[model samples]
Target: MSTEQTSPAPTLAEDDVDLIETTSDASLERTQRRSDAIEREIGEDPTRFRILTGDRPTGNLHLGHYFGSLLNRVRLQDAGVETWVLVADYQVITDRDGVGPIRERVLSLVADYLAVGIDPQRSTIFTHSAVPALNQLMLPFLSVVTDSELRRNPTVKSELEATGDRAMSGLMLTYPVHQAADILFCKANLVPVGKDQLPHLEQARVIARRFDERYGRAGDGSRPVFPRPEALLSNAPNVLGTDGQKMSKSRGNAIELGMDADTTAKLLKRAVTDADRHITYDPVLRPEVSNLVLLTALASGRRPEDVAAEIGDGGAATLKKAAIEAVNDMLAPVRARRAELAADEGYLLDVLRRGNEHANAVAEATLSEVRQAMHMVY
Candidate 1:
């Protein structure tokens, strides 16, 4: 396999910061307005709300994955929305890495989903590779998106830079088209994503609109086959790693979802902090310490400033100890659940099989409609 340097993944906080700094005030306001409109729509009808979300099965999920999107997914499922969770194994090769460990990673990802409360009864969880029609959908989607548009995608740019901008495979470049298919396959109208990912969703919308203009309309001039999916932003705070960078599996800074108390403690003890023993929550001046405070706040359900105030004069040792306790307390149940789920390989496979069946049915129905719309059904 060809080698490339992938950029270290950004923490949720970093993603927000980078976007906030770069986005114009008018653009931010526009997004906020759109969000408010979506919020109102969210309350109108639960049955009409269809959400699509998932992770690449490239590695184990960590706390960054937990707070950022996982929790929101569970909430959506419980709230009676038609939720679809995808294991995007097809996307893992965007970095040109071979598929040797993808099978194990896919199973581990399923185990993590179960452990984190993603009920198969509520959400359809399927592997991307299992849905043949989804890949077929990508072929038409690619027609609407131009090469320059793909080149301009921020996520693609970031991934390319991460891999030292080398080994720029065609698969890597067209992954966004595949993603568009993922969202449209289920006719998902709501996409849960970070601010940084809004562009990808925008591209999906563009593709949907183009497809509709060309072949999505009905004979009676009714609704289009696919809805222009909207971005459902999360208010969750970014969870940085011990190094104060984005918590990532590749970076080795992440505390994995299945880590035990002992492992959590060891990791926290070495988390980057200041030389001074004083504890404060000034992220600007003391990012490393502030990162710890933020994690504790999320874990213990306390405010970061309040946690800082409570730990006044306690120094780095006291702060780290508190973080350790809070993180372990938060993850202990998750760890136990993961262990139980992992022990039952047969059960995990069954869940995947069931989800795949459900997803394939939906994707096939949509693809049939697409083919009919384009006069290819015969």
Candidate 2:
């Protein structure tokens, strides 16, 4: 969802505040214009509007994933925007020392993309590891950014805290640079991101400008190598899991996209709630139950208070049953679609293989220009 919905732009610490405002005047204006154009063309010719978004194949995607990003990706694709979905397998190991079942997760990720309405004909779905050129691009990008700059990234800090790992891997430290490579590889000019990712996107803009100033100019003085990407901030609200924290796989509180009716009900029954006997939509006082209200509203396209009122005079158990029915109703189509897609392993493999070929060709072209710009083409 849009960062705006997530509370005001986070109060940046003095040191970090400047990083957010570091965009050059010219680049800021250019990005603003791009943002405006995207708004104007939402229902018009979106072929020119290129969007890049995807997920890390760490595990199966959950309901939180659907509300937060997967839904927006489909909207953008349906609007005729040129969309590219990346399965970021490379990012899976950045925090942990080792990982398992990556190949399985990648396949599952692709199935979810399809089941969620991401049309491969309209959007390029590819794997990160398939694009070797992205790694090459990351090498040069790392030099342009400093350790202090990387350390200041809020996402990295939060992730470190989440993992409770004192020692940060070199890969974890540099993933932002790698992310820049991903954006620039496809020359993606529009990114759908939440508020927390503002720093990472801003850093990518800095990297793009730095590369352009150093090597993007031709004899004609045109900087065509990369377009600084802009964030299309989502307005969707954050979705909490059954246990009342952020919905995540490791937390074991998430409701995966592939769950059936019985599974959805079981999870909702165990959702956290306060001791109050009455039903109300006081998110501040009863976040656990209100979270269920929010989920029902999102699923039914109604207001939370209205949903709370409809389930009048009931406690957490009443709310749980309502939420279960609403969620299962919403997920019925997605489950059926997922099941159909999962049955065809060969077709899924071909989809990725074809997408990989397309991605490799585009990456090679960008890498060639980058090598030439750096005078490494001898």
Candidate 3:
């Protein structure tokens, strides 16, 4: 296990300072307005949009994954928008030493997706390694970005901090560029992201714009080879772990989607909470208890305050029971479906095989266009 060290914040250059200012309250308000308009437009004409979003197959997805992203992916696919979900397998090695049972984890991830109503038929689910042409775009994408830009990316900086004393790998340093390739390879115009991830999307947009200006036939009749993708900011509440911190698989605090009801109940029993016998929703004052209330609200489709009021004077035991019941009830169907899918490994492989074939076809076409634009088709 890597020990996390607290290092002093790095000094920001002038350009980095400007980049940080973009996330200020006023800028976030503007982003929210744009997101609202996009939501309305999506409802009006879903076919005009294409969304690319996904997860790295590091482990079984937990509640954080469900509420934060998977639910929204299902909604978009069901809304008639073209959706592509990438299993970022190669990215697993960016921070870690080796891929531990990557094949098993990938299949398990597919099971989780299927369990949660991600219709593979409606959405394309493919792995990063399966699409060679997609990775090939990395060369051009990397060329458009500067070393300072890559290092200045907030996501990269945080990821580096998380790795402790391990030297940042070249792969890790260029993670953002590879992500740009993932988005551009499919010509995806919309990407779902949280506030912290906005910088990564911006980097992708920069690469797209720079590549278009440097190599694209702008003055002529042809359109740019890649679209500058915009962020579709998520409105999901940040769900904390049982330990009163952000839920994460590595932290061992996450309640995985694959856990059975009994297992879930057992985990909730061990969850931390306040000594107060009365329950109330005060995230600032009573974060641990409030986190449980929040989870219950998300699971039951009720408000957090309402749940807390109902559980008033019920104490920690009652609070844990409510969370366990609500969460298990919500996840019952997902767990059932996951079990059935896990039993059929052949079916899972077939899903990946078909998705890979489709991804390859799309990536090859995009690469051909890129080669022609750069005058490297020969």
Best by lDDT: 3
Steric collisions counted per model = 6, 2, 0
Q: Candidate 2 residues 140-227, lDDT tens each?
A: 7876677877877876777678767478888998888888888889899889876567677887887887666545442344665788
Ranking by TM-score: 3, 1, 2
TM-score of each: 0.91, 0.89, 0.93
Model 1, global lDDT: 0.83
Off by over 4 Å in 1: 1-24, 160-165, 216-221
Q: 2 or 3, which is superior by lDDT?
A: 3
Candidate order by lDDT, decreasing, is 3, 1, 2
- Residues 82-183, candidate 3, lDDT per residue (tens digit)? 999999999999888999999999999999998999998999999999999999999988877778778878878887788789788999999999999999
Q: Each candidate's lDDT (Cα)?
A: 0.83, 0.82, 0.89
2 or 3, greater by TM-score: 3
The residue pairs found clashing in candidate 1 are 5-162, 5-163, 5-164, 6-162, 6-163, 7-162
TM-score of 3: 0.93
